[model samples]
Target: MRTRLMEAGLHDGATWRISPTPFLLTSADLSAIQSLGQHLLRFTHALNRLYYESVRGAQPTWVADYLDQGKPPDLIAYARMNRFRTALPGVIRPDLILTEDGFMISELDSVPGGIGLTGCMGQAYTDLGWPIIGGRDGMVAGFARMIRSLHESREGAHSPVASAEQRVPAPLPNPPQPSAARLAIVVSEESKDYRSEMLWLAARLREAGLPAQTVSPDDVIFTEEALFLAGSTPLTALYRFFELFDLKNIPKSELIMYAVKKGHLALTPPMKPWLEEKMAFALVHHPALEPFWTHELGADTFELLHRLMPKTWILDPRPVPPHAVIPGLTVDGHSVSDWKVLASLGQKGRRFVIKPSGFSELAWGSRGVSVGHDLPQTEWAAALEAALASFHQVPRILQEFRKGRHVAVSYHDPVTDEIVPMPGRVRLSPYYFIAGEVGTEGASAGPPSAKSVELAGILATVCPLDKKLIHGMTEAVMAPCTLA
Candidate 1:
């Protein structure tokens, strides 16, 4: 497995301890994880609506105020535009930490990495006769279906007979074959480390009968009406592999948005910056929004999300009244009224995490995360101070930290050339793909519909037991998940 991964060229110069065997999950666990996709999808749809309603006067204005804290006005307005109102992320990956009872969702990534890497691992494990959770080519197939759906829907929307509401589009006289549609996974300079994996993904898509390519932002060519590659290679759709925070650094970003706005280009994980914010999880827990979420997400999804999402508090510096305490947050059996009170908690009482909410370069890859128990008292205090200071520009969240249960995993030690058992904590990343269903000629009139969310694959990053963050590192064991 190590040799196969080394030869796969999907690592992009980073290295990890390769596991000799796949991570084992019980049948019940697999079913739960697979069932999570639709709930997450419905949650995402509700969150989008929440944001939009807040922008108008339907929902609380404070909700919009919280989401738009650090965002530029122009970008915020662009995200609220009607042309892209129905857009939702095509890919969703939640970082789930396995605990004693079950698992807790630590974070959700709309523009996540590891698709191609997971695909490679899936193929490698399948070749060894392991029954991988998703099929050997599941990732590739799922991505292809998503892009094809995007292209078909966009093509119909831009047709001469497209409706203003975009509920449905007129049938084309000659529809292009799904394989003939070209796709560009435009990687930004900030995301160059994962470019190789996306390139590998494009190759797999090509093999699955979809014309796809991975290119840098500089390689994109934008005319007044459409976007293309350097060689005038027209594209049918674009998978934005970059984050909105890095838009200023991205070349021709405005042009790309222009094309999308002009209905000349189709993009996934759409340009909704609000959807990329980690604060959505915090909002889901807000008591004032409970009725709103309950109405939009239904009782079951609302309850499930509440259970899965840990207690998260946005580190707002503004003071509450002396009588009022931060809802759902307490330390030492006391209702804390000020954020600074957290700075005084002892190590045992400080089992919390501070991380950037989103729209910042430090938000991803565990860059700006501070674990309360892992640091000294002084450092924890400083982390709290910094989070408060940056609340206006780059908001941060304080979340209850749940420790992962210890487990044993075997990895190949290149120096010893033997498999060795290593005890570690696991972080499971399950990739879910959302594809829309094209309406038939006589279908009822309404908004476009999507099929059930597909669980493409699950990648497990088992870090050494001592490590606080379970991410891709030299000491961590990276592998696919399979049935126990």
Candidate 2:
């Protein structure tokens, strides 16, 4: 393709900066252009038909019925005049034009427009100068030829006639561009130290020469004359039959920015009521939440959120749980009823591990005793009893001695704004005893190793709640000893 472009006079002598331009072409170019237009029209029609039929209540047989069902005149006018367009998967406006040398596609403004990078595929194909067969002049002709061949193969059994050219002599005029002044950013307030993060992100946007501001949900002012309030919160739904409402009056082209914390709050129910209403918004959260939002809310909604909140980015550092508590030593099977576990463990041996259920990072205490020796059993039992008596209400778990190396991992869940592994560091001091050497061959000797931190972070993101939550609850039960 590159060789062909060089062979032709396309890239001759003059230093020409490649750019997108509107142009007029000869009759041959127009014919090829018309062919491409027909192909795109068919594609659009098929797309709309599929979309309408796939909609929950829209039956495939009722397509014509719905079209004639007293819709607004503008909608009926489109269906009546552009029958082919109505048959497509979505509302698509195809703009085919003649460039100086060949045919070009001016636009494909579908129902959900402005598809960012994904929409650039056509231009990319053109720039590459993909070879054109069948007497075609340019990339547009190549695209048309490809679609024509596909259609022919599919219609081989049915022997269907090719679609007639429905190309408009001139391309439709471009819609008015949105004003740059209307741009804004929205963010979630649940983030820890959210204000600081917003300021930092806003500063970065300013540095990049983009006008951006971060506003929280509570801070948003939906004045009656400014914008429509269509979505309802949990509390609002009780009083209103439907969660959706229209303000009916607002200036056109006014963009209301939304910066949402992806996983912090349950937004699905509220958003469900406002599915049909369009609004400008974006979501920012840990990378883990990306898949959920993208898969659950369709690409269009995801793109809308990203565009309205460009400053949002995910920081996916490893995380460690905030707290952990391991049940202290117990006297036989007497449990808390006999004595306090911590005191028992402390008395039984000069060193004992304190592990909280459902928590990671074990704490160890050494009371000047050798590894092999044991403390007096009588003292151990008494201490356990005393500790158990002190904290009678809290639930606790007793874990068997786990002699091994320890590490931690961290992660973030965008669905719930809370950072997984709240405290980012895993406790590793006790692991040194199990390994014999304080500094193992592959592990860090000082504070928690980087690997442990990363592990804790990952665990925080993917670990099941039953496991992690139990650890947290255990930690809470042993909070007093954690401080001690």
Model 2 C-alpha lDDT versus the unseen true structure: 0.24
- Provide the overall lDDT of each model, using Cα atoms, as 2-decimal numbers: 0.83, 0.24
> Could you give candidate 1's per-residue lDDT for residues 266-320 as a string of tens digits?
7777878888888888899989999998988789989999999998999999989
User: Which of the numbered candidates is closest to the native, going by highest TM-score?
Assistant: 1
Clashing pairs in 1: none
Residue 269, model 1: lDDT of 75
RMSD of candidate 1 to the true fold? 3.7
Candidate 1: global Cα-lDDT? 0.83
TM-scores for every candidate against the unseen true structure: 0.94, 0.19
